[model samples]
Target: MIKLQVIGNLGKDCVVNNVNGKSVINFSVAHTEKFRDAQGNQKDKTIWVECAYWTDRTAIAPYLKKGTQVYVEGAPDIRTYSTQDGRQGASLSLRISNVQLLGTRSSDGEGGSSYNSGPSYSAAPQHVSAPPSSSQLNEPADDLPF
Candidate 1:
């Protein structure tokens, strides 16, 4: 029941590796944060997460390039190791089960659609009725603007 969801920008181009007749794609993503401190000073921070997606749909590999913003969900794995400087380090890794392509190239200045544009937007009118039939259209023109 360990589930993790991450939304971030790809850190580098994804690589596909084949081992034991299975395909695995490895990629890293960076998620940034911006916040105001106690003094109202702006601050920014970024978190990096490693993801491994094992799927036969290698077609998605090319799209998982650097700078691609994506949403991934899966189980989390934390590992600790000793660094060369005799310091202990731990990293957060994810074995992604579901990956969604979020947006297009940033250089193009046109990103992908967010859920805001979908039918679920609250501002949109609910259950728009269909146009009137010919009977309703037969009504005499009451407007004098014509």
Candidate 2:
């Protein structure tokens, strides 16, 4: 069995469909790779992956909106077909076994999510009491024959 994992922003809102009485959520994830060419020119290449998550837990569909970052893991499949012009086209798709929302893009197109607008951390850690010293070790080891 082959497994694939992808972390990227959603291309569009997820859609839930019922086929043969089974619910499936469909969405797309786009991953962009950045690199420099031989001439030191920066370039980016984006790969789009279609996902189909079959589950009864469709509650998560609402959160799978456009620009929402997510992590998905599943079985990968490549589909190839012929276009009307006799050209071959291929797409990478996944049958999602698990999906999780990572964050969301701010409305102002900022780099962070509004979900994290509040305090970035919790209260400071409390100091813990020190352990017992050697002198405090169990009545100085009572002598006993094993």
Best by TM-score: 2
Best by lDDT: 2
Poorest 10 consecutive residues by lDDT, candidate 2: 114-123
Residues 1-146 of candidate 1 have per-residue lDDT tens digits of 99999988898899999989999999998989999999999999888999999889787888887877788889999989999999999999999898878764545444533322111113246787899975787556685555
In model 2, the Cα lDDT at residue 13 comes to 96
Candidate 2 local lDDT, 1-146, one digit each (tens)? 99999988899999999999999999999999999999999999999999999999887888888888888999999999999999999999999998877777777756544543211112366678999997887664676556
Error of 1 at 63 (Å): 0.5
Clashing pairs in 1: none
Task: Go through the candidates in order and give each one's C-alpha lDDT.
Answer: 0.81, 0.86
Model 2 lDDT at residue 53: 98
Which stretches of candidate 2 lie above 4 Å from their native place? 108-146
